[model samples]
Target: MTTGNFPRCNCASGALLQGVELAPGLPALQCPACDGSVLKLDDYRSWQPAPAAVTQPPHVPEIEDRPSARSCPACGRLMQRHRVGSSPDFRVDHCAPCQLVWLDRGEWPALAQAGLAGRLAEILTERWQRRLQNDEIRQQREAALRGKHGDACLDELARIRTWLAEQPHRDELIALLRTGW
Candidate 1:
């Protein structure tokens, strides 16, 4: 439900977004109903520092990550969801053609908390996305290995591997173990 020239939010409610000054010169169209914000990439790039002063995440940040894709308010194009990080996993929606971004409530503070608020542009890059995917796969593999080997055995094996890497005759020790007397 939009009035005048303000763009509408893509949230479930589809509320009209209101203009808000994110920083001194950074303006964004924020949804009054959902608290989401629509921001232009140019405005974000030119803006310095941030609008909020958050050194740490709130005790419980109100993050609502949207998994499904949504349409861009500026150009009516599909938005691409980019994973930011783990621990407190969330995705940012970017519309390349429109050069606009749809940030859900609490995403900015979460990014600042994760030390990635200044690198939003970098986060959307192919290299960064691939690295994040690789990290997730590595974590899954580690979890599976830990489950299969159990804590005690895995810990011993890890300790042994660390110790072996420091030894000068590590290869010889491995060979002797393989063909023990």
Candidate 2:
């Protein structure tokens, strides 16, 4: 509840550690100085309480090996398998998970799209989402910045360069740069 340093237990180890919270009700926590996982007192207390063993719920795997044709996280329709870029071997699901595309078995094509403006948009959107910690001042500042910038304002220059280098059209994009477009 407080925004100050608090002692927590390391989930991995039973060590007591210090942690800080940006806001309440957030599951994520970061250590103050060590930058390690800070164990929560509630977790320790629960461990101490030792609740009666109950029937375990059915196990569900987080990720599937085969691609799902179901709706994407980004778009609400079925996600189709498509080669994102020049890499024909690299395949990803499109339009399932509502703008959230999944890269499976291929990392090259995934990295290639990082050169495109889409990566910048994703980064900006993520940054904006992170700033929404119920802190009015931070929220307002982020909102102001968001308003001042359009899609072009999102900067992924370094990432784009790295991705372009790994991509097939690296020379082509570089040539385009020489022509000033």
Off by over 4 Å in 1: 1-6, 23-25, 50-54, 57-60, 87-89, 160-181
Expressed as tens digits, the lDDT of each residue in 1-181 for candidate 1 is: 1224446776778887898864456688898888888878888888786435335555535887776787887777789988888643488899998787888888877777776767889988998888987998998987898999888888898899999999999999989879985
Off by over 4 Å in 2: 1-77, 105-181
Q: Kindly list the per-residue Cα lDDT of model 2 for residues 1-181, writing each as its tens digit.
A: 2323333422233344433331222122443333332223343223321111112213322222243343332234565655333333434444423333333322322333334312312322434334433355665665677677743553455467778889888888888988967
In model 1, the clashing pairs are none
State which candidate has the highest lDDT: 1
> Against the true structure, what is each candidate's TM-score?
0.77, 0.21
RMSD of 1: 3.9
Error in Å for residue 109 of model 2: 7.7
lDDT at 42, model 2: 40
The count of backbone overlaps in candidate 1 is 0
Give candidate 2's whole-model lDDT: 0.38
